[model samples]
Target chain A: MTKVSIHVTLKEGVLDPQGKAIENSLNTLGYDGVHDVRVGKLIEMFIDHDDVEAQVKVMCDKLLANPVIENFTYEIEEGVAQ
Target chain B: MTKVSIHVTLKEGVLDPQGKAIENSLNTLGYDGVHDVRVGKLIEMFIDHDDVEAQVKVMCDKLLANPVIENFTYEIEEGVAQ
Candidate 1:
């Protein structure tokens, strides 16, 4: 099996209200050093196939991420036991 | 500045409807080899503090993640330019 992990993050100059809310909450909780908090999605999956990278890219483009507003990067580990 | 990234994922045995939905979507989209799709959160932030790891741990425990159902891990890079 192949293990794939994808990180999907908002592109620069895009607004992230959820991240802003977390930053505010952190400051209110006295973690004042926290700043510019941005939140994204992490998708992990197992695939029993070859050409894992290309397949994962297609998955990200088709359903996992919005290419217009988000960017995605993935790491693939092969030969993992099922 | 310090750059910290936190990955919050649902603990084993926790129900993940979002992941199930994504898995179903991928199967429907003809990605048959894909399985065990899990969705999580990735939080990236900058902190101007010395004890970044400790501070981030507290943040995770306090507001960033629910200890009851989720587990979190973080990576910190020091001396990042603001």
Candidate 2:
């Protein structure tokens, strides 16, 4: 089974109020070197149904993401990265 | 200049603490039929430096992503997705 990984983030110059909150929280939590924190979304799905790669892409285009203020991309790992 | 859109999401069954929080918040916020809400990360970058696509994939591999418990994908729009 191929495990698909996807990340969604806002375009540059896009005002991110959510990110601002997260950054503030991080600071309060004492995280260092994180002068700038832009929070984004990360999705992972394991496919045992159809073509893993194709379906993953399709999901991204359809329900998995919004193409407006956000963007996404993914990869299938043989084992795992980390 | 080319804009790179990237999406990052949690791997299924990874026990997403952050997603859980968001889902709970969504429910509390009065969003209906949303029995499930999984929140992820989204990152969009504009490149005037080099090959936009190439740098995008690299960024995903390097600092832009964790590659574990997360997945990502993206596209290039001639204009914008509203």
Candidate 3:
């Protein structure tokens, strides 16, 4: 099996209310150094394939991430179930 | 400012319905190779401080992540706003 790690982030210029909320919360909690924050999703999947990277990309582009406001990147590592 | 990337994953033994759904969906989509999947959160923050790493950890423990069911890891990079 192949292990794929996908990182999805909001594209530049997209308004992220959640991020803003986090920033405000941090400040309220007295973490004064925090300037900004952006929240995203990380997806890890195990697959059996010869071209895991390409397949993972297809997964991301198709369903894992929203293409309009989000961008995704992935890393693949080879492994097999014991 | 320092850029911090925090990754939060569910602890072992915790049930992840979302991960299971994704796995089933992949199989239904004809990606038969998929065996298992786990979903997590990725948080990116910009902070201004000399101890960004430690502060980030505090943030994770206090609010960014739930320590009971989630484990978080972070990376810090140094930079300054132009």
Candidate 4:
């Protein structure tokens, strides 16, 4: 099986309330040097397919990520367990 | 600033309904070769602190990750933007 690691993050210029909140929280917790924070999702999937990259792109575009405001990047590793 | 990428994933044996649902969806969408899926979170933070590793550990322990069912790993890169 091929294991792919996908990271879905908000695109630049989009409003990120969750990330903003976390940044504030970190600063409040005495991490005074914190400049910013961005939170996103990481998806790892094991597939038995041959065209791993193509399949992953389809998965990300269809459901794993919101293309309107989010961008995704993935890496594929062969013969790995989930 | 220092940028950190943190990945928090569920530990083995913990239930992963979201991952399961995504796996089912992928199969239904004709990705029949998909074997399994695991969903997690990716957090990127930019900090001006010198001791980045220590600060990140505190952030994960206190707010960024759930220690009971999730495990976290982080990589710190110097002089990077958010």
Candidate 5:
């Protein structure tokens, strides 16, 4: 099996209320240097080895990420399943 | 400015309903080899450069992640702000 790690993030210009809230919370906690916090998704999965890249891309396009507002990038680690 | 990317994932043995749901969805969509799906958060932010690693660790401990059930790792890129 192979391991696929995908990062799905909001596109530029999209509003991220969650990130803003975190930033505010961090500042309130005295971590004042924090700014422009953007929150995204990290999905890791195990799959049988076969066209790993293409299969993962289709998975992202179909269900893992919403193309209208988010962008996704994935890295496949061959034979790294435990 | 420095760019920090943090990946927060559930600790092993923790129940991840979201990930299970995604896995089920993928199977229903005919991606049968997929399994062991885990969903986590990827947080990206910019910070003023000064003890970045320490500051980020504090932020993670204080607000960004819950150490009880999740584990987080971060990578720092220097001078990557736009």
Candidate 6:
């Protein structure tokens, strides 16, 4: 089986309330130099099916993500099944 | 500048606390057919510097993600600057 991983994040200039909350918490934790804290989402799946890339892309668009504010990418690692 | 998108997630059979929380929330949202819910993280950044791939990978390992629990993949989109 091959494992597919996807990353999704908002475009620049897009407002990220989740990220803002995390950023504020980080600042309170005394970690400085953290600018523009935009949050993103990650997804991983294992598929024995074919066309890993195409299938994963469709999954992302259909239910995995919101395209208006987010974008995603995926990679397949063959022989990664354990 | 080129933008790098990183996707991080736990390997299969690995327990995901965040994903479980989201799954419970999704169950409340009435989303069916959701069997395994593993939460992942996504990060997007623009780098004008050379060696974009290497730099992004280093960033992922050093600060962007926890490798012990998460594995990440990144894609470099050239000319993604707006």
Instruction: For each candidate in the order shown, give its overall lDDT on alpha carbons.
Output: 0.93, 0.56, 0.87, 0.88, 0.93, 0.65
> Model 1 - which docking category?
high
lDDT of 4 by residue, A4-81 (tens): 899999998898899899889888888878876888999987888778888889889998999999999999887785
Per-residue lDDT over B22-56 for candidate 3, one digit per residue giving the tens place of the 0 to 100 score: 88988888888877688998888889877777798
lDDT of 5 by residue, B1-82 (tens): 8999999999999999999999999999999999999999999999985799999898889888899999999999989946
- Candidate 3, A9: how far from true, in Å? 1.0
The TM-score that candidate 5 achieves is 0.97
TM-score of each: 0.98, 0.48, 0.94, 0.94, 0.97, 0.58
* Candidate 2's TM-score on the B chain: 0.76
How does the DockQ of candidate 5 come out?
0.86
**TM-score of chain B for predicted candidate 6:** 0.84
Off by over 4 Å in 6: B1-14, B17-37, B43-82
How displaced is residue B23 in candidate 1, in Å?
0.3
> What's the candidate order when arranged by decreasing DockQ?
1, 5, 3, 4, 6, 2
Q: What is the TM-score of chain A alone in each candidate?
A: 0.96, 0.73, 0.91, 0.93, 0.95, 0.88
Pick by DockQ: which candidate is best? 1
Candidate 5, residue A27: Cα displacement in angstroms equals 1.0
Q: Write the per-residue lDDT of candidate 3 for residues A1-82, one digit (tens) a residue.
A: 7778899999988998998999999999999888768889898878888888878888888888899999999987767462
- Report how far off residue B18 is in candidate 2 (Å): 2.0
Model 1, B1-82: lDDT tens digits are 8999999999998989999999999999899999999999999999988888889888899899999999999999878897
Error of 4 at B29 (Å): 1.1
**Model 5 agreement with the true structure over A1-82: per-residue lDDT tens digits:** 9999999999999999999999999888888888899999999999984798999999899998999999999988889847
Clashing residue pairs for model 4: none
The 10 consecutive residues of candidate 4 chain B with the worst lDDT sum are B73-82
